[model samples]
Target: MLEVTLREYGPAVSVPLSSEVGRALAASGILQSATPDPVRDGHWLLRAGSRVGAVRTPGGPVVRVMPKTSVRRLFFLLGFSLDPARAWRDSREGTVDTGAYDDVVPALAHAVERQIDAALRQGVLQGYREVEESALVVRGRLRESEQIRRHFGRTPPVEIAYDAYTVDTAENRILRAAADRLLRLPGVPGLVRRRLAHQRVRLADALPLVRGQELPRWQPSRLNSRYQPALRLAEAVLRGASPEHRPAGSGPLAVDGFLLDMNKLFEDFVTVALREALREHGLTARLQDRHHLDTAGLVGMRPDLVVRTGDGRIPLAVVDAKYKVEKADGLLNADLYQALAYATVLGLREAHLVYAAGRQPERFHEVHGTTAGPDGRGVRLYQHSLDLSREPDQLLLALRQIAGRLAGATHDRDHEIPVR
Candidate 1:
C-alpha cells in the first residue's frame, strides 16, 4: 500500500505516482490538477483546491488533502451548520478526539465513533416503523387492494402492512450506514474501527442501507433527543463522501473517501448563522433566495441570502458569501457585478457580501449612481469578513452585528415598496 499527502489550496507538490494513480486522482475531484512531472518520469504534480479529505485509489496510493484550518474549528463549522441550536450542547458535552493535526480521516472516524457511542449509551433507539409484506397471518392491517391484485382472491398467503415497534428505524439505519461507511474507508484508526464495529453490532438488527440509495429520513423530537447530535454527524458522513467512480476501462477503482467542500461549508455557516441572529431582531432570512435579473425571467439568480421581515412579505437586504480571498486588484469584479445584479433585481438599495476574513478586512463599495441623494437611491454594497479562526462566540457576535446592520436597513426602506 502507498500513501500521498497534500494541503488544501496549497502549492502543488511533486510525488512519485504511476499514470494509473495520477489519472484516477485527477478524476476524483480531490485535486485541482494532476500533471505528469516535466523532469521526473513516473511522477506527477498535484494541487488541491478547497476540498479536504482522504481518497484511496484502488491498487494505488491513498491521497489525502488536509484542511488549512485546525481540525477543531472545522468540526465546529460542521456541527454548527448541521444543527445550530444543539451544536453548543454537543460541543460542550461530546468528546471527539481529532488525532494528530494532519490526520483528518482518522479524526473524523474517531469523532463519529465517540458520538455514536454516546448516543447508544442508554440503548438503541426503537420506533414504530411501517412494514409491508406478504404473510400467512394477518397483522395490523390488510392491504385489500394488494391482496385482490396479487393473489387474485387466493387464500393462505396474504398481503399485509403493519407498524412494527423495532430498532430497524430510520435513526438507527442512518447510524449503521454511517458506521458501515467509516469501517470501509481507509486510514481510520484501529481503536476507532473496533469501537465502530461494536456500535454496528448494537445496531445489527437495523438493516444496512443500499449504496447509492437515498437515506431514510428522521425528524428530531424529544423522544430521540439524545440521538440528534449523532444523527446529524452520521448523516453528514454518509452524504459527504464521494461516490464510487471507475474510469473507462480501469478495473473498478474503489474510491472510498469523505470530503467537505470548504466553499459550500463557509456559505452555509454564514447564512445559517445570520438567519439565527436575525431572529433576535424579528427579521427573517432566506438562503438562496431566487429572483430574475431581467423582465424575461429567463435570467434567474439565487442570492446566497435575503433578509426580510418576520412575515417574509418584504425583502430587506441581499447577501452573498465568498470563501476565497480578496483579489489583489480590489473586490472581485465578478462578485461585485453579481451583487449589483442581486440589488437591481430585488430593487433594494443595500446589498451585502460576506467573505472569509483572512486576506482582507471589512469594507464597503458605494456603486456609482447619478441620483446619490438623501433619498438613499444609491446601492450601498457592504463587504463584511468573518474570521473563521475567531472563537465560536466571537464569530456569532460578528454575525449578530451584521444582523443588526441588516435590521437597520429596514428603516431606510420603510417608505419605499420595491417591485417584487
Candidate 2:
C-alpha cells in the first residue's frame, strides 16, 4: 500500500505505488499521472487535481487527499458567509477545530450538524401540507376511489384528503434523510452522530426520500430563512452521498468520495462577494445572465456575471470569473474574446475578467477598431487578480475593490458624451 498525501490547490507530489494501486488511482480520476518517474523505477509522479477527498481501493486505501486551507476558509470559498443570528457560530467559535479534519466529508458533516442544531432551537418548522388519510370520520374531502375500494364491504371507515399543518414537510423530510445518511458515514464524530440520530427520531413522521424522488422546492421567506444554510449543506451532503460508478468493470468495487469543482466554487465565491459589495452602491449583480448575441437568436451568450440597475433590466457592466492560473503573458485570449462579446452584445464599452493570482500581475487590454457600435468605439477589458491564498478578510476586501472599480467604470460610461 502506498500512502499519498495531497494538498488543495498546490503542486502535485510524486507517489511510488505498486501497479495495482496505480491503476486504481488513475481509474478513480482523483489523481493525474504523467510519464513514469525516471529516477525511481516503477514510480509515478502523480499530482492531485482540484478534488479534495479520500478514495478506498480493493487492495487498501491508496490515497487520501485533503484541502490545504482551513475549513473556515474552505467554507468561505464555497460561498458560505458568517451569520451570528443562526445557531451555528462562525468556524472561529471552536465548534470545529481548524485543520483537525483530514477529509472534507467529516468537515461538511460537522458544519451541517451545527446548522441543524441552531435551527432546531428556534423550534421545529411546520408548514401546511395536503395529506390523505382513511379514518372512521371524513376530514376535508373524500377520496372517492380509496373510499369505494375500502368501503365496498365496510362503512365504518372513510377516506379523506385534508390540509394539515405539521412539521412533516418536504423540507424537513430532506433534512431528516440527510442526517440519516451522515450518521452512516465513517469518521463522523460521536457527538455529531448522536445529534443526527436524535434529529432523525424527531422527524420520524417525515417521509424518507425514495429513489429518484425529486427534492421539494422551497421559497425563501421569514419563517424558512433560518433553515437556509442548513438546507444548503444538506443538499450538498445528499449530492455527495449518492453512489457514483465508472464505466462497467473499469475499476475496483465502487469507491465513495466527495469532491467540489474548484472552478464553480471560485466563481460562486467571487460572484456572491461582488454582488454583496455592489449592493452598497445601489447596484445588483446577476450570475449567468443569458442574452442573444445575434439577431437570428441562434447564438446565445451567458456571461458569468452582469451588474445591473436595481430594476435588473438595464445592464451596466459584464464580468467573468476565471479559476485558472494565468501564464506569464497574461489572461487567455479566449476569455478576453468571450468578455468582449458579452460587452459588445450588451451595448457596454467596458468589461472585466477576474482570475486567481498567478505569475503575471493584473493588466488591461484595449480592443480597438470594433464595429460593435455606431461610432465604432473600442471596448476596454479589465483584468483583475484575486489571491485565494489570502485570509478571508483580505480576499473579501479585494472583491470589494473590484466591485468599486466596476461601478466606477459603469458610472463613467453612463455620463460619457458621444464624440460625433
Top candidate when judged by lDDT against the true structure: 1
lDDT by residue for model 1 (66-161), tens: 888877778778878888886545544323446554467788888888888889999998899999999999888999999999998579589999
TM-score of each: 0.92, 0.77
Stretches of candidate 2 off by over 4 Å are 1-4, 9-47, 55-63, 79-103, 133-136, 145-158, 240-253, 292-295, 359-362, 371-377, 409-420
| Span of ten consecutive residues with least summed lDDT in model 1 | 411-420
- Judge candidate 1 at residue 210 and give its lDDT: 94
Q: For each candidate, C-alpha RMSD in Å?
A: 4.2, 5.4
How many residue pairs of model 1 clash at the backbone? 0
